[model samples]
Target chain A: MNLLEWLPFIVLIPLISSGIVACLPGRFWPWAFTLLAALASAVIAALVLPEAMGSELSYPFGNWQPPIGIEYRVDAANAFVALLVAGMAALALPWAKASVDQEIPERQGAFYALFLMALAGLLGITLSGDAFNIFVFLEISSLATYAIIAHGRDRRALLAAFRYLIMGTVGATFLLIGIAFLYMMTGTLNLADMAERLPEVSDTRAVRAGLAFIIVGLGLKLALLPLHLWLPNAYTYAPHFVTVFLAGTATKVALYVMLRFIFTVFSPDYSFVVLPLSSVLMVLAVAGMFAGSWVAMFQDNIKRMLAYSSVAQVGYMVLGVSLVSAIGLTAAFLHLFNHALMKTALFMAVGCLAYRAGSLKIQSLQGCGREMPWTMTAFALAGLSIIGVPTTAGFISKWYLILAAVEAQSWWLVGLIVITSMMAVYYIWRVIEAAWMTERPEGATRLKEAPLSLLIPTWVLVALNFYFGIDTRLTVGASSAAAEALLGVPTGGLP
Target chain B: MTDNGILRIIARFLIPFIMLFGLYIQFHGEYSPGGGFQAGIVVAAGWILFALIYGLKAGLEVIPEKAMYWLAAAGALIYALTGVASVLLGGRYLDFYAFEAFFNTPQAAQQFGIITVEFGVGLTVATVVMLIYTFFVRRKSEWDEVMRGSDAE
Candidate 1:
């Protein structure tokens, strides 16, 4: 069989498995089924990546041709993202079983089902070539995410979920409206076709309105600065595994969508030159970088702190996009990949701590470096990556970002980037200090190391941080190629 | 509600016809505007009316809570499996033309696929509507129980 036929299964495996898992009896079967399905998805995505890197692979639903029927189209850009999301799910599920059993003892079947459905939705958003199709997958993922967040051990989880629901619904609606406007203007739902047709009508007021609506809507989803209110609480209170998965995948996918629209569906000239969006994005990105890191320094809850740090990380990615150059896009995509690695590793280490300490407060982590040496070491390593320390994955992306800023002739932005790295150092150090330096609180129970099931996955991700940092071939090659594809340029070696 | 004999009699007389009309809408949807979603809500409205007239306890006896959850899942599964079936038959996913040999024509196979998936949609939509209704209706007591449990804590 031709390998292209396997494209749909990247989404279908998890979609079908979700139903099967929901129907399955007992706890073990659901978790086992989800893991198998997630692994299968990752393998298929991996197999397809090489082909996708060479050329676009298109799968038309029900044998209908594109520009008519919905299509799953994978190129280097989305294929890389699809792999990141599917790979994260595969790696995190082994850790999930132990955490889920502790926190969500009831309705294990339903939880696993929603998890798979959410996985399917994320993959669908990455692979779909149609604009409307992206919206459908976005809702499918967001609805499942809200429900998953509500299952957290804290009662505040419900409030967080509800707040997310309201914000998410508004975002989705704005996106739909924007798509509607695009549909009205271009008369096509297919993104490529719309791109081809949009130039004729790009001057129209409707098209500009659609672009604005799309930016704001996606801004909310990606938690871009002023629109980022819903992210911290949602990430903080979500079940540990849920936070890990969503943190690594969700906003990154949203950023991917924004990148697709700005670079592919709409020309960069139209977005940046004609529209003045570059400066707007640049200003918001810089502001978010400072505000997010500054607030992160003050949070008592470790999860909340990391959530704010994510806001700052998003600023770095957006900063890359605002540069509107090939190297800058590469930097953005590289960070998108690297940040997923480091952040998920960070959250998983936190999950291990939560498993042992039963709380996420900084005080709860006091002396954890002594009690749970393995888990805390993983945390410190991932923390170094987050701080952009040398020979770690985060450093590679920061180097590219600084290079991109220098190439753009933005000396002040480079200064800002350096300052923010220092800010990251300050916040990540607080946790390391709390975990390693401080004495265990009086009357606190002695903590054992987290079980090997959780520690193994945490270390595997931590290992990847160092591995990818040192090995630039895969991350740099794929990201530069993806950047070239997004810019619609011919092959060029790294700048 | 139980003491309102006239209201109960009217609901009992109207319920079957309401469900029959919903079936008519579902089957006729292939030719007309109404389809599974409208049909599902119509049928659910009948069920809701029955509960209103005869009490929730009696309604639960007719369609238990557990069955609602299973049926909701089963309906969606049926819809997905039909698409899988087309794929297994060596066609693209959800390609109804894969069933052409069995049905003797492409159009008939397409019709068959659409009708089958519509039936699945109808089942799911109907059951989910009832499920949401039950959740809302039961929320007060569930909340009270939660409050009582929290007091003990």
Candidate 2:
């Protein structure tokens, strides 16, 4: 079989490896095995892209056809998402080795095993063609993440993990109920089939209720504005490596599912016109952007600040979705990828600082920039990307979003996007000033630079941000194709 | 430790039957409602009852914590390896039809495949439950005290 034929292995390899890694002898077995698994997954993901970009690939388990047995589908949207997730896992594995050693000294094997399981879960979420299968994978990742988060050295990590568990469980339950409703209405759990049948019963109360439950359920998972209470603590208290992985990939997966449901499983007219979800989403997006940024500006802890900033960043993507236009959806898709690169690098840089300085407080960052020049430099560059500075990945997404808003002639939204981004600059600048301009406290011993293991991954992401920023062909091309695919337009647009 | 002589005698007599029944459920699972999950729980329940009547010490003696860890890992590996076996036999992962090449008929191979997979699941489920029990009831404070003593030494 060709690479496309083996798409299921992209998820299965990590899962099977996780089980094997858990049983392997020696302390380092988990790390080594996970890294190998991640590398294999990345290679497979890249190999599948040429096929994925051209058309969707669907594989049935044990040769059973869809709507009867489980199926894995890889369209441009999900294929790109799967590639992004697998690639992040590959990059994060090395960083996890050094950071996990310091953050969690014991159970390294279980930690790595769980990490791989989480990666497999994410890949499963993106690739599954069935709604119920998505939930199964969602819970698998959630269970693993809760344990990993609780493994943080801080005492509060346990409490944070507990809170996250409660909130996450509720979200999953809501999503499951919504899926059941859809299944009941349509008599099929397959998303493609649901899309075909949903319109026939669009006016039914059950269908409407299902849509509502799904949106709210995914809202909680994605940490969209008002429902984002569990995010800051979970992100702040989880071990730094876990933070980096989850921040980069977890919400992005949830957002992708939301997009899939909105555009593929349900008609846009029903969502945007009949239900007024567009208006609701637009209001929530604007509020989330303002409120999240406003709160982020005042945070004392650097990690928590970034966590809050994530809420704001999600707002931008949601805003793009609310626009309900081809360019708007493309902007949303591009931002999802761009934001992953930006946040993963930033969080990794923070992890480096936490490794050296022994605290994540902004005050502790003072004057360490000079001591850890390479690390801080990466921080600054990623910070600029967050601010949507020219010649960075963040700008590309924001540029398209602005053009989309203008096309819709929503000048106020244009103003809102620009203004909220200014807030992004202010918050990011706080860390920069602390790192670059402030003096090291009196009589403090000089700290050495972060280890190469951590610094290398951070810089790799930083370089990707700039490289993709300068050459927009890959990200833009894939996102536009995905956007067109979602909008039901023929796949030949330059949006 | 039990004051009731009849209770201990009855408990000793019943433990063997419980295990036998668990095995019966596990092997008969693919053709019936009871499968690996229920059988594993039943087996674990037998062990727990023995601990309750005979003391946790007797329970640990029968199935040590170290052994429990290995059992859990081994069970999961068995399940995973079966999938890999199918792939190696020129079929998709988890495709039992590939086993037809080995057996005289496809039905026998499928039966073999399902039974083995169920056995693997039973092994994992039982051990995991025992592991949790050990952590929750048996080790409570003594494990930490032992660690502390070792550190001091």
Candidate 3:
């Protein structure tokens, strides 16, 4: 069979396994099965990525032709994101057995089942070529996410999950309404077909409203500032492993969907030039950066602080998107990948700390630098990456964003980027200071290093952060190719 | 409610017909307005009526909580497996025409595949609905006991 033939299984394997996992009797068996399923799906995504980078791979469900039946279309952009999501799932699973055992001991089968369902949903969202199919997958993932979040031991976890559900449902509704408008106008759900038909009706108010709705709806999902209230609490309160998985993948997938809609379906020309969305996005992005970073600085809980930092990082990606250039899109995609690496590693490190300390408060981590050296060092390194220090994955993304801004001749935006990087420095410094400078509390129980099961995945991601930071071949090459594919140009100009 | 003779008698008489109608809806869905979702709800409604009249314990005796969970998973598994089977038979996922060799005609194969898929959907929907109903009907004290037990762990 051709490489494209295996594309559906990237989604199907986890989807099928989730059902099986749900029925499995024992905790160990369910977890073992989920890990194997995640590994299989990741391998398929890896196999398909090389082919997808060179050319689009389309698979029609039920052997039905497109513009009619749903299709799974893989190109450089989505294929890269799919690999990140699937790869993260694989990486996170090995860490999960230890974390889930400690954090949520009941209904382990259900927990693993939901985890796989969420993974399948995210992958499905990345692969789907139909607008409606994306919505279906979005709900599938969102519903599973809410349930998983509610599994946190704290009562606040339930409240956080409920808030997310309400906000997420509203966002999904807006998205569905937007899709309905577009379908009414274009008479097709297939993204490529819609793009072809959209030009004639692009000037219509309904189409414009549809565009606005799509942006706001996806904005919520991606936790764009002002719409990001659901994120910090949800991240802070969810089971530790869940926080790691979601921090790495969920918002990044949402951003990829937004990119697909804005660039592929709506056309950059229509979205940027005709609509004047670029400036609005620029303003929002910059505001998000400052607000997110500013709020992150004051947070006492390490998880909540990182959650806010994610909002800031999201702003950087959006700022890249606002430039509407090939280089800019590359920067956005690059940050999307790099952020996943650093954030997942950071969260895993936090999970390790939580595993040992049983708390996420920064004070709880005092002297952890001496006690859990491996875990704290991993955190510090990932923290350095998030601060956009040189020779880290985070630095490469910021470099590109600066490059994109300079190309657009927006010098003030460059200053803002640097300022946010400094803000990142201070917040990270607080944790580093507490971990390294403060002495262990007198009479405190001795804390051991996190078990290798968790540390290995954390360090692997930290290693990737540095590797991608220096190598730049895979990250830069794939992102530029993805940018070119999205823009339909050899360079930065609109098609 | 269980002490009400009229309600119990009527529920017993109506449930079989309600279930039979649900099956009819399930089979006739391709050409009509109702399909798995509607049929599943209808069939589940009959069981719910039985539970409401006969008591939750009696309903548990009939279907059991554990069986409901298994059935829910089984239903989804059946649906996904149908798609996987088509892929194995050299067709794209969920392509009913993959079964043409066995069914002797494309239309027949398509019908067979749709029916099987819908049946899976129906089974899952029914069990899940019943499960939700049971949970709602279950006492809050019982739920608290379960929660307290887990928390104690």
lDDT of 2 at A172: 92
Kindly give the stretch of ten consecutive residues in candidate 3 chain A with the minimal lDDT sum: A486-495
DockQ of each: 0.80, 0.58, 0.90
CAPRI class of candidate 2: medium
Question: Where does model 3 sit among the CAPRI classes?
Answer: high
List of clashing residue pairs for candidate 1: none
- CA lDDT, every prediction? 0.92, 0.89, 0.93
- Give lDDT tens digits, candidate 1, residues A62-172: 899999999998899999999999999999999998999999988998999999989999999999999999999999899999999999989999999999999989998
Model 3 spans > 4 angstroms off: A492-495, B141-153
**Which 10 successive residues of model 3 chain B have the least lDDT summed?**
B135-144
lDDT string for model 1 (B10-111, tens) is 988899999999999999998888888889899989998898888777877889988988888988888899999998899888888988879978999999
**After aligning candidate 1 to the native by TM-score, how far in Å is the CA of A113 from where it should be?**
1.0
Give residue A67's error in model 2 in angstroms. Answer: 1.2
Model 1 stretches with alpha carbons more than 4 Å out: B143-153
Q: Select the stronger candidate by TM-score from 1 and 2.
A: 1
Q: Quote the positional error of residue B6 for candidate 3 in Å.
A: 0.6
Question: What's the TM-score, to 2 decimals, of chain B in model 1?
Answer: 0.92
Query: In model 2, which regions exceed 4 Å deviation?
Result: B1-5, B143-153
Answer with 1 or 3, whichever has the higher DockQ.
3
User: Candidate 1's interface RMSD, please?
Assistant: 0.8
